[model samples]
Target: MSIITLSPAILDAQADGRGIVALESTIITHGMPWPQNLEMARQVEATVREHGAEPATIAVLDGTLHVGLTDAQLEKLAQAKHVAKLSRADLAVCMAERRTGATTVAATMIAANLASIRIFATGGIGGVHRGAESSFDISADLHELAQTPVTVVAAGAKAILDLPKTLEVLETLGVPVIAYGQDQLPAFWSREAGLRAPLRMDTPEQIARAHRMRAALGLPGGQLIANPIPAEAEIPRDVLAPVIEQANADAARHGISGKALTPYLLQRIFELTQGRSLDANIALVLNNARLAAQIACRMTLLT
Candidate 1:
């Protein structure tokens, strides 16, 4: 049985050798509430199209792994309750069980690779959780970046996580952490995370070249492009720090752990910031989507 399905738009793009940027479905399924999630999904896809790239939003539906979702499929997935968040470990199992699932960063990278899409855009990647040294709760997204060959563009690791520790783990894994247009890594909602980026690239062509160079050198894993949120959209690191700390404390108080921790922290931050966090998140996501499209287009030209 054929397990992979491509939307008509993506199929046409592939046939025409046009650029295609892969997007994760969890942003729709797990990142926001119903109507907003659906609206964001549509807007992000439109952004990709406007930038001359096709958007392939990956997900699993009724035992089929879809490389791109139709408008109806995206709407249904956004509104569906309790969708399984599939990561590296359970992506295949979810498909095998004929269950509908939203792909996280790791699973999305896996699917993007399977479909020959070399670039993925997301709001942020998960990383070393706070107290990971004791809790051993690092996100699989980090490991996926260490092995998957698709370039991932995000603001950075979620701010609720331990940013320095996340960068340390990425360094240990030998992944290239490139900050776009700046020397500092970006926090999810903030332009500056107060950590120095190991590499810096100012243009999409440069990033695309770096990605190809890695493949030429036979390197495992992909690059992490820390694209900063627009200045007006950023919440500023100092302002977000206390908010994150409070949210983390709340999570610990409520005994939230594992997959539940991220959503809980994000929701709390949204409330704590009076909806500013979600606004920043949407802005950053759209920014990353535009950059991912540019990179994908550059890669297509290189190929």
Candidate 2:
């Protein structure tokens, strides 16, 4: 049996020359619980299709790297217990062990590139964690973007990370941080990070052209398209700053570090914001998926 399995929809889309958008599975397996994850996954796939692309939600199920999940596979994975979170480091290890795994941004990009899928959408990319100078807890997503030739569309790096440090590291990695239709990059749940984006493109066509140009120039890595959340759906940075600070403080107080740090902070923020954070997350993810699909369509047109 082949290690990679494409759903009939993706295979059909490929044959028909339709655009395809790669989606990360961590958003389903690790981002939420129960039926909500299933609903969100369905809605994201539908959004991709509605915008003229097929959605390939990446995961490793029973050691097979599934590029596009069937509804039954999606439901099973959503409810699976002890699913490993696969990044650049452990993705192959999990597969070798024949365990189920959810793909993070890095792992998803690797899978998408292997499958020749050019675009990926997700809520936010992980980055340099806070106090990373001490903990050295930077995320592999940054380095993956430095080498993988797959365009990733995300609202931004999670606001809980050190945004400035993350930006600096991306710069060091020679990644183009392009904000879509805006001057400043987004801050995940918030619309503004107070940091000017390195580049800006206002339309899907321009973004697609840029992607093509990168290949023409033999660029090593992918573009980071920072698609900001719609204004009405965004939580302002001013409103979110204190909540993030409080969350970080709580994590530090509890001596939370490493992988446990992020989820802890996010949960605290969700509680402090009275569940508004998750709502905003859903909105931003949907928004990113829509933009990613548009870009994917333009990508095929350019091809």
| lDDT tens digits by residue: candidate 2, 1-303 | 678888898899999999999999998888876888899999999999999999999999999999999999999999999899899999989988888999999999999999899999999999999888988999999999999999999999999999999999999999999999999989899889999999999999999999999999999999999999889888899999999999998898999987777778878998999989888988999999999999999999885
After superposition of all CA atoms, the RMSD between model 1 and the true structure is: 0.7
What lDDT does the true structure give each of the candidates? Answer: 0.94, 0.93
Give the 10-residue window scoring lowest on summed lDDT in candidate 1: 27-36
> Can you write out model 1's per-residue Cα lDDT over 13-41, one digit (the tens) per residue?
99999999999999898888778899999
Best by TM-score: 1
